[model samples]
Each structure stands twice: as structure tokens, then as C-alpha cells.
Target: MSLVEAEIKPRKSLFVLKTAKTLFGELDALVADQPANSTAARAIVLAHMRETLVAARADAEAELLATSKGIRCAQNLCNAEDEIISAIHLFATKRVYPVDNPSEAETLAVSAVGGYGRGTLAPGSDIDLLFILPYKQTPWGEQVTEYILYMLWDLGQKVGHAVRSVDECLRMARSDMTVRTATLEARFLTGDKTLFDQMVMRFETEIMAKTGPEFIAAKMAERDERHKMMGNTRYVVEPNIKDGKGGLRDLNTLYWIGKYFYQLKTSQQLVGKGVLSAREYRQFQRAEEFLWAVRCNLHFLTGRAEEKLTFDLQPEMAERLGYAKRVGMLGVERFMKRYFLVAKDVGDLTRIFCTSLEFNHAKDMDLVGRVFAPFRRGKVKIKGDADFVIDSGRLNIAKPDVFTKNPVNLIKMFLVAGREELLFHPDAIKQITRSLRLIDSKLRNDPKANNYFLSILTAPQSVERMLRQMNESGVLGKFVPEFGKIVALMQFNMYHHYTVDEHLIRAVGVMAEIANGGLRKELPLTHELLPQAQ
Candidate 1:
């Protein structure tokens, strides 16, 4: 079994349905005298099931609050949901609409999709389900599916459901990326095992076969769109934990790409697949755990699926997560600071993962080069320097120890990328991150190194982008210690939309945009002044 399946597989010891048999027996007795199709009888049965399951969910949630175990809480919630859904399926087929000697067309395979399919559920999260029919739907199949959905709706459970045949699923997935992504995480819950197995076999062989590169490109485009929608930065004060840039969705995108290419069972397997190093995997795990904890708490606190970490709830969330006041910082401020740092780590992991894909030839380097072609005027000729090389239109260190030999190379690399209008190779960024300790006060104050840093800051092409790369790789902060202090600093004011360092970078980006005529219509005065000042 996959790690996710195992994590959410209801433990017999802590099973939510410990008293399910007795409850079902009582339900059977209650409906014994009434007709199976009787509306009054069905109401009673549904009510009984709803009451019982609601209490079980409450108990599970209370345990979660007491233990403060976020991942386990999600698992147990999913397990509880599974028990409820499975019980409803049985009840619907046997009692509500019994079919004698059902035909092949009547076979239905139920599966969980989306985040629910990953075997994690926060309080009030929608339970996304997919019902797979053998071929065309039969009367009995439709009746069973509707009955199950109605029962869940009556229980106040939000459900996102779809009924499709194997062929229909494949067709829709082929035409729709959202559908394809949803089906990628589908896990069979209950129903016709043979039918489910057949669907999985065909999906892997037909739909997913040789489509890894396309899927990766599509996901990257989707991610870029999402980031743009969410302020195009990870330092938003009231961040959306699920959909914001560097949020849970970003992490899931990494997992999805890895899984699509390698059929990874767990995210840990990404390390083995060379998609992530061991240390980076740990960073991934930590960020995931912290984000999940925050999301779960958000839901519990709001009594709904609230995702944004708004100011009103920040203090309480911080307190609940054990964040305490420090001498100069409030607990909420500290909590938010940690959250932004984790988001930054996620951004790092994304770069590392993409680089791995390029290095492994899983991603098309030519496509990547084309994506960044708009920023290039023409590649500037490189002076005599063996320390750097251009690979697939990105700047890369020629040797692993280039930075160790001269810490000043850290500053020079970004300067070169800016002048040439290129981004850093993932390996180059990794090397810079590892070699941060070598950047000391002497190097920071060196004439050549300072000159390189200034050149990067004032570069006519992609100045903002280069500075962000440097900032993300730890080079900007190391070379300027004052900037390091504000890397993740929260302003704790309603007016400030981003962290201190992010605000500074964004201000620079705005100036660059004005200078380049990108924002001339909106800021003509700034555009006029930018060239003059330079």
C-alpha cells in the first residue's frame, strides 16, 4: 500500500465505527416494518446515520485538539469520512434500492479524489468522490449513487462528486487538465474491485503513458498563473495557506509532477528518485507538516474551511500552535514570520525540483529557454572567466568549488546573470546556498564584490528578477547583513501587505518596471524620474 493509504487506513483500535454494527442493527430494526422505498422510513434511517457519524466526527476532532497532532488528525478525519461513506454505500445498495443479481453494467467503483484522495481532511473540507461505472450507467447504479449522495448531504457534509465510466473519465481527463489532475490522485474507496483495477490499468497504460513532459509543462503554467493571482509573492500578510504562492498547492504540485513522472507512492520516494535530496526532503516534510497544522487549525477555529490566515485569528492561532511572545516580537508576529520562512523554503524546493527535472532530462530545456526568451535582447558576450558557463540559456557555475575558491563569485554570478539576462541553473543556486558560510565581512566589503552587487542592482534587464534570485539563494542577505535581518520580518500593520524584505524588493521591481516602460501608463512620473535618477 502507498504511504498515504496506510496513513489513512482506519486503525481497528481507534476505528470511528467501533459501534457501527450495533447502530446498523438498530437501524435495520427501525426500518423493518416500513417499505424499503418509504420516505418516512428512509428519513429515520438517514437521520440515525447522520447523528451517529456527526458524533464520531466530533469525537475525532476533540482528540485532535487535545493531542495537537495535525497530520494524524487529518488522517483520522479521512478515516472517519471513509467509514461513513462505505456504510452509506452498503445501506444504499442493500436496503434503499436492492437489485437482485445485478448485471455487469450495474457495477460501480467508488474512489476518493483531490485532497481527500490523498487521505487527508481538515474540518469542513469537501469530500471529493468519483464513482466509476463499468460501462453506461444502469438504473440500479444511478439509484445507489444518488441515495449515497443524498444521505451525505443530509448529514451536513459537503461533497464534490462525479459519476463517470472508465472511457468517459479518460476522455474528460485528456481534454481537461483539472480533470486529469483530479484523477491523478484518485484512490479506490469501495465497490467493484475488478472494475477499479481495470480503470487503473488502462489509465496508466493509455492516459498517463508518455505524457509526463506535457503534464509538467501544464502544471508549471498553472502554478505561474496561481502565483500571479495570489500577488506573485509568498510574503502576503494574510496569506492563503492552500492556494497562495508557496502554499500547500505549490507543495502538492511538486508531488504531482514527481508522481506523474516516477509513479512515486509517497513524497519521501522523491528523494530516492533524485527529484529531491535528503536534506531538501526534510525541508519539504517540515514545511508540509507546519502548513497542514496551520490549515487544520484554521478550519477548526472558524468552524468552516477558512484558508486565509487573517489578522483577527492570527493571535489565537499562534497561541494554539505554542508560539510565545519574545522580548521584541509578539507571538502572532513570530508565527507569521515562521510561516513566511516556510513559504520561502517551499519556493527553494520548487527551484531545486525543477532543476532536477531539467538535469534528468525529464523537462524540456528548449521549452524552458523559449519561456524566458522575451527578457533577452541578445546574450551579452562573456569576458574571459572560466568560473561561469551558460547552460540552456541559464547561468551555471563551471565547477562546484568555484565559490569556495572565491566567495566574491557569489556576487559576481548574479551580476553575470543580470548582464546576460539569464536565470541561475538549479545546481548553481544549490552551490550558492551551500557556500553561504564562506561569504564574510571582508568579501562583502571587497571593492570588486560590491561593484558586482551594484551592477546587478542597476542592470537594465531583469534587475528585479536577478535580485530576487540572489535573495532566494541567500547571497543577497549574506553579502548585506542588514538585509538579512529583515528577510522574513513582518510589519504587523494593516497597511503593509508584504514582509519587509519583500516590500523592498517589490519597490525596486516597480521602479524597474517604470524604467522599462512596462508600467508607464500607471506611473508616468516614476517612469520619468527613474531614468533621470539612474
Candidate 2:
């Protein structure tokens, strides 16, 4: 058995196991007879490896058809690939540079990084890896890394790989946020566990120490940029499920932050620490599972790593996942609706979780919180019961009933927050979620609450930020029942850049900018004609 098969649990199905055993036996025999330095032998090994991989994928797909669970199917696919990679590694190691000590092969540890490292890989996703050398690249380490890459290329696997020594990893991680995040999620696949252990220890101490604030800031910035690129909405009609604003990337970002700051091994740990409510954790799991299923279906259908829920692919995917046409909607629309809902949930969970981090790690979060320092120093306060406190300009509502006791406080919070250009500390947001039931029809129709919400929409500054927070916290939906219908409403076109809610919020933000004369520089014609037009 291969190292991956032996070390990893939940073995492949009997069919797959037998197939792998036979194919691996053949490959092993081939590797044994071929001349170690012969290029011809390398070609033979590559051919056999490719055959084995194709067979493995076929077996996995058959298993998927039987199980019908995306998570299990994906994990099984990864396992099959792991064993295949191991076989190739063993063959490549023997051919490129025969190990004299045998045990000395432990000097080079091969690990999966990024999505592959996460162990829920989408079919045909790039296999990201790290070749961790005990020291700077020696001849043996160089040959081994080169051989692995060459063979993967020959087999036509899209690969992102890095060759680094332990010290080099630390230096790069300390300097680059992207590298740091990837390194933090690295998983040992084969070879030196001892070396992998040392690298992980140094990673925690040398890379993770004193870097929480900077890392969080960088991730947030990256997320904002990504949202901007994806039309700044979770409800894009043809959303990129993996990288879109409120997609799987957002979920992963939450996990990455939790892992980094709290040393969490899994998302469940967040619930245990009270950072995430049990209900919120379920939301996270459902979103993740749904996205994973959609992604896997997309990959299997297209025979590549395709994540975008494009027009043509929608109907088939919907039908595959058991959606059927209804009275007013097509199966495709229903499916897309559910997908957008998942994205929205991911957004909500992210807001709730990050807010917890900000509140709990205030001292460690100063680097990002500095932007709100001036507001914190001011006396701007909103009406709340004894449950409220201002921490670094963010309103923290400690009482669970703060919102229920006065449901208008939900709309009022946004109104006050936008007017003052402040934020709700994460705890307050969590409280708002618990109080969502209080925002029933009576509260929604209260003229005073309605006016307060409008006032928030027209706030001179921070209108967009506050409105987004309201949407994320479920306040907007509960306050305006109509708005709830369009939370993740898809337009099914390219012209509409955002979902209905996002578009509405963005328009309000633009109106606010115009009201403040902030857009005068860009809208010369509007500025010139405003007085006469009015």
C-alpha cells in the first residue's frame, strides 16, 4: 500500500482499492526493471501514472453516483489522487536519485497546501504542494522536487508548487501575507513527518507570533478587492462559487482567521469557544456543504475546475441536485436562488464571527481598529439599555434582550451608526440576530422605525457600510419583508452588476455621495446642472 493509503483512514471502496492495487503493482514492477537514469524509463512511468489517475477518477465518480454526498465523494477523490501521487513520488524518487540510506528520504517532506491541503478538494482543482527541505536545496532535494513537477506536468495536472527550506518558509511567511496563510494550512502528505513537524512548530512561533493584526487586515483588504471585482455582491447571477464575494472563499477566510488567532483546528472549535453560536455553526456547515456540492458538480460536468454558475450549466446542475420546475420558477432559477442564499448565510456568519474576533481581540486588533480611533474619542452615543458600551467606536450590546425590549433599536442602530460613521461591535450584531423575531409586522410598519431606516439610507456618510451591516445582520430583511425576497435575488444577466439588495444599497450610497457634493468632481455635468434641474 502507498504511504497516503496507509496513513490516511476511510480507505477507498473495494473496487477502487483493488484497481489501485493491481495498477500500483504493475507500476512498481515497471519501476523495478527500468534503468534508474534512463529517460525512456521516465516516459514509461509517466504513461502508467496517467493511466492509474484516470482509472482512479473513474472509480471515484462511480462511487459518487452511489453515495450522492459531495463531501464524501470529494474526500474519496482526494484520497485516490493522494495514493496516485504517492506512487509517482516513490517511482520518481527511485529513478532521479536512489536513496543510499533509505531513511534519509525523510529529509524532504512533501505536503499539500491551500485548497488541496484543506482536504475538500474540488475535482480538477490545482494540486498545490510544498517541497519542504530540511535545509537549503541540496542536490538530492533539487532532483526530487524537479522530478515530481516534471511528472505532474507530463500527466497534465494543473499544479502550484513551492520548494522551500524551513528557514526560507519562515522568512517568506513573515514577509508575505498570502504565503503566510498558505503555509499555515499546509498538510503533510508523504516523506518526512519529523521535518514537517519542525516546520509547523517554527510556522507557529516564527510566522504566527505577533502577526494577527496585520494578517487580518490584509485578508479583509483582499476580500474587499475580490468583492469589488465580482461586482461587490453575493447575489451575482453567474457567481463564481469559489472566489465570489460571499462564496466559499468567504467561508475559508473565516476559518483561516479562526485558526490563526485562536489556534483552532476546525470550524467546530469556534462554537465551543462561544465565538459562533450553535445555529450559526450549522449555517456555516450548510453553506460549505452546498458550495462544495455545486463545485463538485460543476467540475464533474465540465471535466475541469469550473466554478462559475453560468447560464447553460445551471439547468443540468439543478436537475442533478434534484431541483424541479415549479409554478413561477424554473429549476435553474430555484437552484441559483438556493446558491445565493447559501452565499448570504456565509456573509452573515462571516460578519458575526469577525465581529466576535474584533470584540474579543481588541488589543490585538488595534492595527485595523485605528481607522475608527477618532470616533472612539468622540462622545457620539446611541440610546440603548444598560447592555450597551462603546469600545473603540463600535457599539457593543451586552444584553440579549436589548433589541427585543425595543425592537426599533434595530433600525435605530443603523440610523445612529450611519450618522456617526461608527460600527456595531460584533457582540452587538450577535445580539441583533437573537432579536430578529422581535422585528415582526408591527415593528416593520411603525412609522417612526420606517423613518429611522430611511434616515439611515440618506445618511451623509457611511451609508453603504451601515446598510451592508444591516443586510448582513438580517435587520434589513426583517424590517422590510419585501427586501427579504430579494436578499439573494439573481438577475440572470451581465448588465445588473449586483443582486437586488446590493444594487439598492449601492444606489443609496451613491445618492448620499451626491447629496454631500462628494461626487461633484467626477460628475461634472451633474454638478453643473443640479441647481437648474432641481
lDDT for each candidate structure: 0.80, 0.75
Which regions of candidate 2 are displaced past 4 Å?
Answer: 1-23, 30-41, 62-68, 94-97, 100-106, 136-138, 367-391, 445-447, 451-468, 493-495, 507-534
Task: Write one digit per residue (lDDT tens) for candidate 2, span 1-534.
Answer: 110111224645633643444555677678686685687777777888887778867776676555456666667677766777766676666545767675443368898888788776777789989988876345787787888888888889899999888888889888888889889889888777888889999898866777777788788888888999887777667889888977888888887888888888777888888888888877777777677778887899899889888887888998888789888777877888798778878887877777666666666777666411333432234455344556567776645676767788778777766665567766677678778888888997899898987887666677788878888888888887889888876665658756678788888888778878878878888777877976
Clash counts per candidate, in order, are 0, 0
- Model 1, poorest ten-residue lDDT window? 370-379
**Residues 395-458 of candidate 1: C-alpha lDDT, one tens digit per residue:** 8888778898888898898888877766777778888888989989899779999988888878
Error of 1 at 33 (Å): 5.2
Kindly report which residue stretches of model 1 are placed more than 4 angstroms away from their true locations once superposed: 1-26, 29-36, 362-381, 460-462, 511-534
**For every candidate structure, what is the RMSD over all alpha carbons to the true structure, in angstroms?**
3.8, 4.6
Whole-model lDDT, model 1: 0.80
